[model samples]
Target: MSFRDEVEDGRGDLRKPFLHTGSWYRMGSRQSSIMGSSQVIRDSSISVLACVLIVALGPIQFGFTSGYSSPTQSALSKDLDLTVSQFSLFGSLSNVGAMVGAIASGQIAEYIGRKGSLMIAAIPNIIGWLAISFARDFSFLYMGRLLEGFGVGIISYTVPVYIAEIAPQNLRGGLGSANQLSVTIGIMLAYLLGLFCSWRVLAVLGILPCLILIPGLFFIPESPRWLAKMGMMDDFEASLQVLRGFDTDITLEVNEIKRSVASTSRRTTIRFADLKVRRYWLPLMIGIGLLVLQQLAGTNGVIFYSTTIFESAGISSSNAATVGVGAIQVFATAVSTWLVDRTGRRILLIVSSFGMALSLLVVAIAFFLKGFVAEDSSLYGIFGILSVVGVVCMIVSFSLGMGPIPWLIMSEILPPKIKGLAGSVATLANWFSSWLITMTAPLLLAWSSGGTFSLYTVVCIFTVAFVAIWVPETKGKTLEEIQHSFR
Candidate 1:
């Protein structure tokens, strides 16, 4: 049975706004209440910025965990005497662990509040890294990867929600983008550092972000919305006050938040049966489709084994090339942040998917040609250069849109009521697809690098069609308007 069909027990409505928790906070009961009150007063952005930066450490650690495998693959495998299959398992195990963590993430965040969920995530990440660092055998290494993946799964959901809940609307998009940007930064850090350190030393270094985040979490106030949701009104007001600065009046924003919370809290838990309606199922399908396709393009396969991919391409400085790709990913993602709002979601996605398809096709063809020429021949060297160029362009294309837009569109399109459950389903699909790609990438490369990427190229081509036909233009429309169009 499929995930959607089998998980239909629908025990309860997800009690939290799992995707973008604070989107409703911007809803006001009266337009004048938003405009005429002293509550309209602006607070210093400093405090909010501080909180975001502190929590951003979580995504950075997440990126570090992901990029860790690529740089350390050779060293770790040699040190532990692991075969190719064993090493692939080591790389893919985190996605399995992350799947477990993602499943539990929403409820955990709901039960304990956003800050608490992050603390919960951080502990496992620390333990996971230490385990990897101290490992003497595959058992420790595998366990560590799983632990790290589990931590990342929770972080994947919680950090963005937490940042959204705290930030003002004006700052929300930019600040939320930080989560992804930090992740790329973290990946680059791993690639750069891996060039010098042993795998063990790199694992130890991975623990540093969480170590700082734990104590830092203590200083930042909890999400006011989460506090309000849990019926801690006094704490909620105080938390909002702290976030807004000491003297900024929060009465207007508070009333709006209370109204939103009251309306939301009264909602009946959604059931899978409700998805029979086109309005519900359509968005859910689009959300899951985008997420799954994002992974099926084999981005993680390339990322997890980038150093090995470079080596196979006959690049002399494969590790350095890996570091270069990581740096390019960071820059490309930053450019994407600027382009997403201005250019709109659908355009970027179409462009991204098409670009990836074109880029992968180049890689596939280059690899195919490499087989025809002698290794020392000039033509073979040209194919090798073409492969590197293709990989770099593919990553740049992915960062431009596919990397961030799927989640953005998912959050924008999913109905608020079923966001918790539906978002989980979508997230699970993404992790599962990632696991499949990462697990098979090494074996596929062993079989035929050209064939492996040719498959991805077809997936990306399908993605371009999917986005163009099925995905709606969500830019410049309210959630209600977007939903209405679906109806």
Candidate 2:
């Protein structure tokens, strides 16, 4: 049977499928107060942008968690009397917590709604930071890090998905890229603040993003697509109207969303066995492949151990250099935000992977040459400087595409019916790979700095090939439209 035929399901008059509820009326009254007609008439983009910015804070918190270890590693290790292995475990435990969180994130978002899930995520992050700040022992510190990672894992999946769902097709790429942009800002803030603040103070500062996010979430509408899928038809239409602008005619768009949802068995639980279907497995493969490759490229390793990397490169002010790298990353991601819609996802990803490969190769070569020269020799110092340059270039390359695009693509390509289960699996794979890379980076670097980066370079090279072969271009497509392309 045709998809449309199956979805119609004897429901006559498709145009009248939705019926208003008392709850939608209540929501409308509140919406009227917040979204005065005068404001909506001007341009609807502002509302969507505001919502994206608010949720973007979650990723800022995510970035702060990722960046926290870099600046505070030395101070925290000394204060807690942690060994190299213990500190590495400390750095990687967030990934462990994130893996657990990733496993549950999809179901939580699916059950509670995206806005509610984010609210749940914020509480743990705030508590996690507080625990880290007041901790007098390693146990508290470890617990706090785990809690923070748990929050980050949820934020990682929900923010991009939320942004993609709300944004207009023309704006989706840029808005989605904002997730990574905010994350870079968070990382930058952590690095910058770490320079001036003690480790405890930095931990305390990490609480601010969630503090802002918790209140901000109440102001935005729940995702319209999620509402539609759950049979909250009236609320879904109202939410979409508010996002698109009260003055905008939303009939065609509303119908499109209805058809998309109706085509699926909305209440049917997707089994692991169902994933064997071409439609289900194809997007799943693309989503999972991108996410796993994103981590295997060793981003967290560079981020978690950036200070140490700079010190090894012979930089006297390694902390300051780490901050500079953070700044550069934020700038690169910002450029990517502007370019994603215009240049397209596949092109940017291919270029990003190649640039990362080249940059890591440079670092590998610099480290290899450094080992052959005397420590005090001119060539040794030059190679050290070269390694620093390579790391910066690698970060810039990564931020431009690999950092943002995978999450964007994952959110875009997956069909709404199976997104929750499949997204969790993909997110779990990402965190697992991250944990492996983060846990082993210190040991790998100590064993052979050149070899560690050489391995990453090889991964980056493979990423280029994977994107060229398997990944699709998702630029300027609606979520429903993108899903159809996979078929």
Candidate 3:
């Protein structure tokens, strides 16, 4: 007998969604959400990789928007003759657009299916980039940034959920992690290109991924789990076979999917109120909590203010330190992708949380000492080195787990019935926390850099406990198995 046989009794628990939760949430309400999956013959791994890569482009676009202003800040400001206050608003409008996008993403993805949603998201991004490329005024830049941010917001939720739904259990962790990897790559590439290209040329380049993604969507299979949820059994099976390889036996997988679907209550509409159940609420809390902790770890505060921190620590070239931190984040996140499947999710999260706490404490101490010592004291040199080390260590710890794992786990554990709603809420919380941290970072640093990092240290320590106690290992589990563990 398979694991399903032994766990048959628990199917009753899964059925709660269909009987109650689905009713309130309008589950499976849209049949025409997306076109039918295309017939294709290919290895399962190739199909999965191809799909992930295509979807991953959205994140690259997201990163480009994020990194664009940093390198071109002076040039753009000078060319546009904008005030610091105006430029500040221009910088921040993206978060506003993202929050709006987060709230709408669930409804959009659910109504149109993941592929259709990506198509919708692409339109605005292309238009947004064009607006930026052709802009002659500050308002144009503002509108363009807002549009791109909104598009990225939608893509953020869809890509991970799409990847989670399509990836085979064995490859899920690594592939899911690719979303973060792509974002980092985009940021790095943007920074590198900004060195040579004019800001307008760079803005035009932002259109590249969306251009590729629009056509690329046609080649990949629609998510099989999505097909199964929509009650299209034939298409569901066909999609699964394409993902698993044309010649592979899908009988065992099909039975498991059938059992998984059967376990859910399929007789009702979806409802937001359905979240009162332990099954749904538990995973929702975990996803949102991790996102909260990820932000409160003060990663953004450090990123936003790293140059200043280095300057305070007595470094002559703060920009070099900032760039070094970015490189560390990209490298650490890259290593994480390889280790996620091999080492498992829970362990990495725990290690990451505690490691960050420890690193922040070092910086906190360094900053605390900066005030009392004489400027030319020997300790000043030591403290400067400590700050750099602390900041880099924090970046390494974060990139290893907290940075990517929250997004990966968020994509994995939520049931399809509540994925859009729950995912949107979680994504919103993440951006909210990011905005909060970035906005307040300078304030906190001015008040007391030590105090700010100390607060972050406390949060990271709490995260270590939270993950160790609540986060389950999700390395090799299917999406169904992951949701099951939440109970």
lDDT at 274, model 1? 53
Candidate 2 local distance difference test against the native: 0.87
**Candidate 2: deviation at residue 252, Å?**
1.3
lDDT of 3 by residue, 330-407 (tens): 899989999999999999999999899999999999989977888789987998899889999998999899988999
Candidate 3, pairs of clashing residues: 18-265, 22-269, 22-270, 23-269, 24-270, 24-271, 25-270, 25-271, 26-270, 27-270
Candidate 1 per-residue lDDT, tens place, 451-471, comes to 999999999999999999999
As a TM-score, model 2 comes out at 0.92
Checking candidate 1 for backbone clashes, the offending pairs are none
Model 3 stretches with alpha carbons more than 4 Å out: 1-42, 263-269
Candidate 3: global Cα-lDDT? 0.80
Q: Which has the higher lDDT value, candidate number 1 or candidate number 2?
A: 2
**Prediction-by-prediction clash tally:** 0, 0, 10
For model 1, the superposed segments whose C-alpha errors exceed 4 Å read 1-45, 224-262, 266-278, 473-487
TM per prediction:
0.84, 0.92, 0.88
What CA root-mean-square deviation does each model show from the true structure? 7.5, 4.7, 7.8
Ranking by TM-score: 2, 3, 1
Q: Who wins the TM-score comparison?
A: 2
Candidate 1 clashes: the total is 0
